[model samples]
Target: MNFAPTPRTTSLRSPEKLRYDKATAYDVLDAAHICHLGYVHDGTPRVLPTAYARIDDRLYFHGSTGSRAFLSARDEGVEVCATVTIEDGIVFARSWFHHSVNYRCVMAHGRARLVQDPDRRLQALAAMIDTLADGRSADSRPPSAKELAQTAVLELALTEVSVKVRRGGPNDDAEDLSLPHWAGHLPLATVAGEPVPDTGIGVRPPPYLP
Candidate 1:
């Protein structure tokens, strides 16, 4: 489904880079485990980077129940903005002004609800664990009731969403393009290295680990 454009969802700066494709937005979001959550507390705006999991069209992020952000969303849903970005490369150009980073990103805006349902909360927690490794939720012990009580999960619907991407080399001016300077993009990616097991219990890592 394509997200309908809203005033907040439209990109005013780089309008050409804006996309409404929900599939592309989902891909960008799923590729990164961290999301910058923007919220307001006591009329002061704040942005916090936190781990999040996406299930269908909603996102779930958890934190200590006493956290200011969680507290702000507890009683009544709070307005929020969630963003995920994946850096693909560094764009090298003939001029410094044209240099930029190649990236895929998604921005979501909505009222974040504090999740209270037991089953939904458990599912969100499992999805979050599995994000680290395909079956990590199954390998690890489930959180105890006491532990769950101390945690708060916030849910945000992906209603006002926008995907923006910048790719290829930097946009060099026509005159600068002929200059004697190397212009190309240096590709980047996240690659997992050999797993270093923790102390005690000498068993190989599960196949789920890269």
Candidate 2:
């Protein structure tokens, strides 16, 4: 499915880099586990980094029930924007103006609703854990009643979404090519390091871990 861009989602700066396809948006979102959630609280704009999970066309994120952002969102049903970004490389150019970073980003806009249903909330929580590491939810203990009561799970549909991507080498002017400075992209990636088991657990590392 293709997402129809609203005035707020249209890419006025780099129209060519903007994507409206759901596949592109989902790819960017699923590739990253963290997202920045933006909302207004008491007339002040705020953005907080949080973990998220995507199931179908909906995105789920959770926070402490006492959190101001979550409380405000739950009470008011205010508009929110969730963005996920993955930086692939740094583009070095002959000139500072041409230097840029290669990245894939997706922005979703909607009003988050508090997940009140117990079964759905559990599923959302499981998704969040599994997104961090596949099969983790099954290995870990499920949330207790008190723990669930202290958490706030919210869902936002991916109805209004946009993706922007930048890749390859820098776009330097023809005259700048003659400069002595090297121009190339330094690729970056997020890699898993050696796993360190907890001191209390003697069990071997699970197969799900990298």
Q: Please tell me which predicted candidate would have the highest lDDT against the true structure.
A: 2
Tens digit of per-residue lDDT, candidate 2, span 1-210: 899999979966889889999988998888899999999877888999999999998999999999987888776565889989999999999999999999999999999989899999999999999999999999999999999999999999889999999999989999999999999999999999878878897667889998
In order of appearance, the predictions have TM-scores of 0.97, 0.97
Where model 2 places Cα greater than 4 Å from the true spot, the runs are none
* Residue 105 error, candidate 2, Å: 0.4
Residues 99-193 of candidate 1 have per-residue lDDT tens digits of: 99999989999999999899999999999998778899999999999999999999999889999999998899998988898999999999998
Whole-model lDDT, model 2? 0.92
lDDT of each: 0.92, 0.92
Q: Ten residues in a row with the worst lDDT in model 2?
A: 69-78
Q: What is the lDDT of residue 23 in candidate 1?
A: 92
lDDT for residue 174 in candidate 1, whole number 0-100 = 94
* Residue runs of model 1 more than 4 Å from their true location after superposition: none
Clashing residue pairs in all predictions, respectively, total 0, 0
Considering summed lDDT, which 10 consecutive residues are worst modelled in model 1?
A: 194-203
